[model samples]
Target: MKLKPTIFVFAIWATGLCHAYASTSHEIECPTEISAAALAINAPEGWSAYAQEGLRLRSAEPALGPPEEKAFLKPGSTKSIKGGSIDSWLELSGSGPTGKWIVCRYGERGEITLSKKLHDNTSACTVSSRREQVQVSCTW
Candidate 1:
């Protein structure tokens, strides 16, 4: 079988486009003070949970607990990006300066939704709605 020149060119272009889209970066712009480690879900909640769900992730299982992966987070950057997971919600929960707690959500489609300042002891961040804005709850 012989492929036409135009067809071949389109095919190459499409392949390149696909690769770019697949590797596209989803970035979250947080203040410089936030460290990569602090911008993610911590232990006793998201950590243990993600370890448990790692199997589910490999088997295409549903999300079992708080979000673990960076999804599309920038390397060594705590921007709390999205678009890594195809269908699941992940979180970033931590206590900020002076124990100001915060939680963020990294959705299945690579969407990052950071919660308002929460209680320092909050262990997880779950999504909800309040005052027509994306509200997140810190629990456990």
Candidate 2:
């Protein structure tokens, strides 16, 4: 009976300690040489753009939690914004506490399409425009 109390106390302490170190907050800076068009594209609804040595994109949605991985093109890096294709990687960080986040890159082609597989659900997006103006919308 006495052991039960002691075990409960230890378990609570261990859980608290784990939660304390679960997530970290840091400021990400953006590169200065990014193209005007890239700069103009509004970050996803809940992301913030920062200007640091390297362009770092931070998420502002506390509910979605911190990002596991972030993706962005380096300044002066020219990617083919045509044929509805892009070469990008979804960066990940944090552990299971932070749900998975995705990076969808699309070209500035006519009605570009972007799709991602999240677990069993596949999400699709489209970017319609080729000039400096690009628009993107995603659907699950």
Candidate 3:
């Protein structure tokens, strides 16, 4: 199989549903905590893994013997991958206000780190938090 460079676009909508766009790609939804494992096991054969921070997929069988180069994910940005086009998105939320971040990347043997920090806001009577680093990895 041949790999095409494609962009994965994710947008947060008002209803809390994530909107995603990619060229000739299919969408897969996984549980918030197990997204990394799900993507790895569910990826089609002959397609490698690609993910952003906090997300990851296992390596896929390459059409050729080995892959040319590895890919990495950028925080608050998108990355493209080779081989089969399998794209996915995950969301998590509780009762109060919510925020969402999306990252996209492609290639093999790639990794990223994700973290979170929480802050209390007395003025707004709300608790604010930010994800520090989210890790993602892929190999072929």
All candidates: TM-score: 0.22, 0.21, 0.16
Assess candidate 1 and give its TM-score to the true structure: 0.22
Residue 75: error of model 2 in Å? Answer: 16
What would the per-residue lDDT of candidate 3 be over residues 25-98, giving only the tens digit for each residue? 22222113425444444558998676443344232211111122222221222334343233222112222232
Per-residue alpha-carbon lDDT of candidate 1 for residues 3-117, written as tens digits (9 for 90 to 100): 8999999999999988764522122222222233444455684445222221100111112232342222221222223522222233333433444333343434334434233
Tens digit of lDDT per residue, candidate 2, span 1-140? 36788899999999999987554322211221233345444679889865333222211111122233333222221246664323222223232344432332333321222223222121232323343333333332
Of the candidates shown, which would achieve the greatest lDDT relative to the real structure?
A: 1
lDDT of 1: 0.35
lDDT of each: 0.35, 0.34, 0.26
**lDDT of model 2, residue 75:** 23
lDDT order, best first, reads: 1, 2, 3
